[model samples]
Target: MKKTDVDVVVLGTGNAALCAAIAAKEQGASVCMLERAPKSKRGGNSYFTDGAIRCAYGRFQDLRAVLPDLDEEQIQQISMPDYGEEAFMADLLRLTDGQTDQKLANQLVSRSFDTIQWMMKQGVQFTVNENQYYEKDGKRQFWGGLPLKTKNKGVGLVQALFQRAEALGIDIKYDAKTTALKQEDQLKKLIVEIAGEPVEITANAVIFACGGFEANANMRKTHLGNEWEKAVVRGTAFNTGEGLTLALKAGAVRYGQWDGCHAHTTDYHAPKTGDFNKPGDIYKKSSYPLGLIVNVKGERFVDEGADFRNYTYAKYGKETLKQPEQKAFQLFDAQVSPNLRKEYHLPEATCYKADSVEELAEKMDVCPESLANTIRAYNQAVQPGPYNPAIKDGKCTKGVCPPKSNWALTFEKAPFYAFPVTCGITFTFGGIHVSPESEILGDDKRPIAGLFAAGEMVGGLFYHNYPGGSGLMAGAVFGRLAGEQAATFCNRTKPLSSKS
Candidate 1:
C-alpha cells in the first residue's frame, strides 16, 4: 500500500469539495483532493446542474460585486428585484414547511453573498440568467429570486474551479475512493482505493464533501422508499453515500429528512443516469408552471401553479413517480407555447404537437376523450383576469378541484402540445449533522476532532422541498466554512512537519 501525508484531505471533486480545497489552501494548509471517479468523470453532481445559485442581495450594486463584467447598458436592459436575507430565509422556511434547521439556514442565508464573491475571486464567472426573466414592456423582468448563473452552466463552474485549484498548487487524485476513515492521536487516516490498489493517506484534518446517495439504487429504495428505485438519476453516478457511511461509522449522527430528496420533472426518455456528453440540465422540463400536468389517466394530480417554478419544481418529480406508470404529461396551447422554456425546444425532447387536444392526447397514448374533457373543464374554470407570469397575479381557476393559483389562461388556441415526463432524482436531503463552522457532530451532539463536512453530505438545511439555486449556494457556503475550520484545526493540533 502506498502512504502519504497532508494537512487536509478533501473527499469528492464537486463544487463543495473544490471550494473546501481552495479555502484550505488559502488558509496556508497543504490540501489534497480525492475523487472517486476517474479524471474524465470528475466533478460530481455539481457538473450536471444548470449552475444557478441563489444569494441575498440588497441592490444591483450587490450583484455588481459578483458580476463585475456587467456594464451599464447590460444592467439597464435587465430588471432584478432585491432579494434580501429576510426574503431568502422566508423562502427556505416556506418551502421546507418550517422544518429546515434554523442555524444552518441562517448561516447559509447570511453568508451567501460573501461566498459568491469568494467564488468569483476564485475564477468562477457569473452571468445574468436570461431564462429566469421575461420580456414584459420591453425590459427583461426577472421573476424568481434567482437571477444569476455560471457563465456556461455547470461545465463552466467545474472547469473554472479545477483551473483555480491547479493554479493554487492543490493536489488532486482522481480514481481515488476513500472507503474508510480512522482517528489517530492527532490526525485522521483515510483508506483510499486508487485504480484497484489500496493507498493510505494521513492528514491533520479531513473534509467530506462527497455528496448524497441519489445515484445508489439500493440506498434510494431503503431511504427514499421503493418508488425511488425506478426514478432516474439526474446527476453523477459516483454519489453512492459512501461518505455518509464512513461518517456514521465514525460516530457521526444522522440528520435531516432521510426520505426526502430534491427530485424534478425530467424528460421521460432521459437516460436512467445523467449523460456526461449531454451535461447541463437539458433533460429537465420546468415549464409546467405555464401549463397543466396530467397523468396517463388524463387527470390532474398536483396544482401546477401553486407557486413559481423555483419552489414547486423540486418536489413535483415525486408526485410524478406516484402516478400509475410513474409518468406524466405537461399540456400547453399555442397561446403559451411561445412562453415555454428553451428545454422544450430541444431536439431530443419527447414532445407531441397537434392541431387539437384530442389529437395531442392520441399522440401521447392518453385517452383522447378523457384528456379533452379534462381540458374543457379546466378552460371553463379559469377566471377572467390579467394574466402575468412575472408575479403571482390573481389569475386563477374558480371551481377546479386542483386550482391553478396563478397564470390561469384558457387553452383555446389552434396547436396543442404535450411533453412526457418522469421523476429525476437530483440529491438526497438526508445526511450527517454538522456545526455552524462545518465540524462534524457525533451522536451526542459533540464535534468530532479533526473531522468536518460540507455539501450534500452535511444536511439539516433542507427538508420536504427545496428552493431552486439554493443547493449549489449551500454547497459553496458550507464548503468554505468546513475548509476554514479544518485548516484552523490543523494549525492548532499538529505542526506542519509532523507525519505518521
Candidate 2:
C-alpha cells in the first residue's frame, strides 16, 4: 500500500469539501482533497443545485460586499427587501418546527453573511436570483428572503472553487474513496481506495464533508422508510453513507432526524439519479404554488398555496410519494401559465396541455370526470380578490378541504396544462453530531481529536422541512468552520515545519 502524509485531509469535493480545503490552505496547512467520484463527476451534490444561497442581509451594503458588481442603476431595477438575521432564524426554526439544534441554527444564521463574503473573496462570483423574483409593474420583485445565486448556478460555483483550489496548489485526488478512518497516536489514518488500489493516508486533522445517504436505496429504506427506496435522487449517486459509516466506526455519535430529508417535487420522468448532462435543478417543478396539484385519483393532496414555494416545496414530495403510484400532477391555467417557472417551459418537461381541464386530465392519464369536478369545486371556492404572486396576497379559497391560502386565481381560461411529478430526494437531514466549531463528537459527547465534519455529514441543523437555498449556505459556513478548526488543531499538535 502506498503511504502519504498531509496536514489536512478533506473527504468529498462538493462545495463543503472544497471550501474546507481552501480555508485550510489559506491557514498555511498542506491540504489534500479526496473525491469519491471520478474527475468527470467531481462536485458531488453541489454541482446539481441551482446555486441559490439563503443568508441574512439587512442592508444593501451587505449585498454589495458579496455582489461587487451591483451598481446604482441595477439596484433601481429590482425590489429587494432586507432579509434580517431574525427573519432567517425564524424561517429556520419555523421550517424545522423548532426541532433544529439551537446552537447549530444560531451558528448558521449568524455567520451566513460573513461566510458568503468569504466565499466571494475566494473567487466565487454572485448574481441576483432571478427565479425568486416576479416581474410586476415593470419591476422585478424579489421575495422568499433569498436573492443570491452563483453566476451560472452550481456549475459556476464548482468551477470557481476548483480554480481557487488549483491556484492555491491544493492537492485534489478524484476517484479516491475514503473507506475507513482510524486514530493512531496523534494522527488520523484514512484507508482510501484509488483505482482499485489501497493507499494509506495519515493526516494531522481530517474533515468529512462528503454528504448523506440520499442515493443509497438500501440505506434510504432503512432510515427514511421503504417509500424512500423508490424515491428519485436529485443529486449525486456517490453519497452512499460511507462517510457516516466510517465516522460512526470512529465512535462518532449520530444526530438529527434520521428518517427525514430534503425531498421536493420533480418531474415524474426525471432520471432515477441526477443527470450530469442536465444539471442545475432542471428537473424540479416548483411552480405548483401558482396552480394546484392533484393525485391520479383527481384528489388534491396538499395546499399548494399554503406558503411560498421555498417553505413548502421540501415537504410536499413526501405527500406526493404517499399518493398512489407515487406521482401527482400540477395543473395551471392560461391566466398563470406565463407566471410559471422556467423549468415548466423546458422542452423535456413532462407537460400535458389542452383547451379544457377534462382534456388535460385525459392527457395526464387521470380520471377526466373526477379532475373536472375537482377543478370546478376549486374554481367556485376561490374568493374574489386581487391576484398577486409577488407576495402572500391572501386571495384564498372558501369551502375547500385543503384551501388555497394565497395567490388564488380561478381556473377559468383556455389552455390548461398539467405536469406529472414525483418525489426527488435531495439530501438526508440525519448525520453525525458536531459542535458549533465543526468538531465531530464521539459517543461520549466529546469532540474527537483531529476529526471534524461539515456539509451534509454534520446534521442537526434541519428536521422535517428545509428553507430553500439554506442547504448550500449551511455547507459553506460549516465547511469554512471545520477547515479553520482543523487547521488550528493540526498546527497545535504538529508543527508544519516538522512535516515533510
Candidate 3:
C-alpha cells in the first residue's frame, strides 16, 4: 500500500470537514481533507441544505459583523428581533425536552456567531434570509429565530469554503474513501481507497466530520427502529456510517439517542437519496402549518399548527413515518395556498388539486367520505380570529380532535390543494461522545488522544427533536473547535517513527 504522512487528517468534505480544515490551517497545521465522493460531488450533506444558519444575534450590529456588505436599505427592510444566547439555549433545551447536553448546548449557543465571523474572515459570504419572514405593507417581519443564510444557499456555501481551502494551500483529496483505521505506536494510519487502490495515510491527529448514519439502511433500521427502510435520505448517499463505525471499532464511546434523528416531511416522489442535480431543498414540504397533514386513511394524525413550521417540522416527520406505508398528505385550500413556500410550486412536486374536498380526496386516492368528514369537522371547530401567517395568529380550532393550535383557517375556498409526502431522514442524532474541546471520548470517559469529532456525528446536541437551520450552525461551531484543538495537539506531538 502507498503510505504518506500528514500533521492532521479531516475525514469528509462537508461544511464541518471544510471548516475543520480551514481552522486547522489557520492554526498553523498542515491539514489534508479526504472525501469519499469524487471531485464533482465533494461536499456531503451540507450541499443538500438551504444554507440557512440559526444564530444568536443581539441586534443589527451583531449581524453586521459577519455580513459587512449589508446596505442601509437592506437593514431597514427587515425587522429582526434580538435572538440572544439565552434564547437560543432555551430553544435547544425546550425542543429536545431538556435532553440536550448542557455543556455542548452552551458551547453551541455561545460560539454560534463567532464561528460565522471566523468563516467570514476565511472569505465566506452571507445574506439576509428574506424568506424567513413575511412582508406586511412592504415591511419585512421576521418570525423564526433565523434570518441569515449563505449567499446562493448551500451550493454557494460549499463552493466558497472549497475555494477558500484551495487558496490556503490545504490538500483536499477527492475520491479518497477512508475505509478503516489502525494504530501503529503513536501514529494513526487510515486505510483509504482511491480508484480501487488501497493506500495508507499516517497522521498525528484525526478529525472525523463525515456526518451521521442517516444514509445507511441497516444502521437506520437498527438505530431508528422499524419501517425506516423506506425513509428517504436527504443528503449524500456516500455517508453510510463508515466514520462512525470506524470510531466505534477504535473504542470510542457511543453517545446520545441511538433511535433519534432529524427528519421532516418531504415529497413522496423524492429519490431514495438527495439528488445533487436538484441542489436545493425543493423536496421538502414545509407549508403544512398553513394547512393540515393527513395520513393515508384521510385522518389528521398530528397537530399541524403546533408551532412555527421551523420549530415543529423536524418532529412531524417521525409522525409521518409511523403512518401506514410511511406516507401522508398535506392539504391546503385556496384561502391559504398563497402562503405556501416556493417549493410547493416546483414542477417536481406531487400535488393534486380539486375544486371540492371530496374531489380532492378522490384524486389523492383517499377515501372521499373520510376526508370530507375530517375537513367538515375541522372547519366547524376553527375559532374566529385574525389570520396572520407570520406569527402565532391564534386562529385556532376550538372543538376539533388533534386540534390545530394556530393558523386554523377554515377550508371554505375551492380548488383545494393536496401534496403527498413521506419522511426524509436528514441526519441521525446518535454519534460518538466528545469533550468540550471536540476531542472524541473513549468508553472510559477520557479524551481519545489525537482524535476529534464534529457535525451530526457528534451527539448530545440533540435528542428526539431539533430546530431548523441549527444543523449547519452546530457543524461550524464544533468543526472550528475540533480543528483548533487538533492543530494545537499536532504542534505539540512529535512525528511518529516507522515502528510498525
Query: Each model's TM-score?
Result: 0.99, 0.98, 0.97
CA deviation > 4 Å runs, candidate 1: 495-500
- Tens digits of lDDT, candidate 1, 252-357: 8899999999999999999999888989999999989889999999999898999999999988989999998899999998989998999999897988899988
> Using alpha carbons, what is the TM-score of model 2?
0.98
What's the lDDT for all of these models?
A: 0.91, 0.92, 0.89
lDDT of 1 at 466: 92
Residue-wise C-alpha lDDT for candidate 3, range 1-500, written one tens digit per residue: 89888889999999999999999988888888998889888799999998889988768667877777778887778776788898898889889999999999888999998888888887779988766888776778888788889988899899999999999999988888788888777579999997789989999889999989999999999888878876999889988899998998887888999899999999999998988898878799998998989998999998988899879988999999999989999999888888788899989999899998889999989999999999989989998888878888888998788999999988889889999999999999999899978999998889888999999889888988988899999999999999999988887786332224
Model 3 CA deviation exceeding 4 Å by range? 495-500
Q: List the residue pairs that clash in candidate 2.
A: none
What does the lDDT come to for candidate 2? 0.92
- TM-score-better candidate, 2 vs 3: 2
| Shift in Å, residue 374, candidate 2 | 0.4
Model 2 lDDT per residue over 6-104, tens place: 999999999999999999989989999999899999899999999999999887566877787788888788887889899999999999999999999
RMSD of 2: 1.1
lDDT of 3 at 331: 93
Clashing pairs in 3: none
Model 1, position 384: C-alpha lDDT score: 93
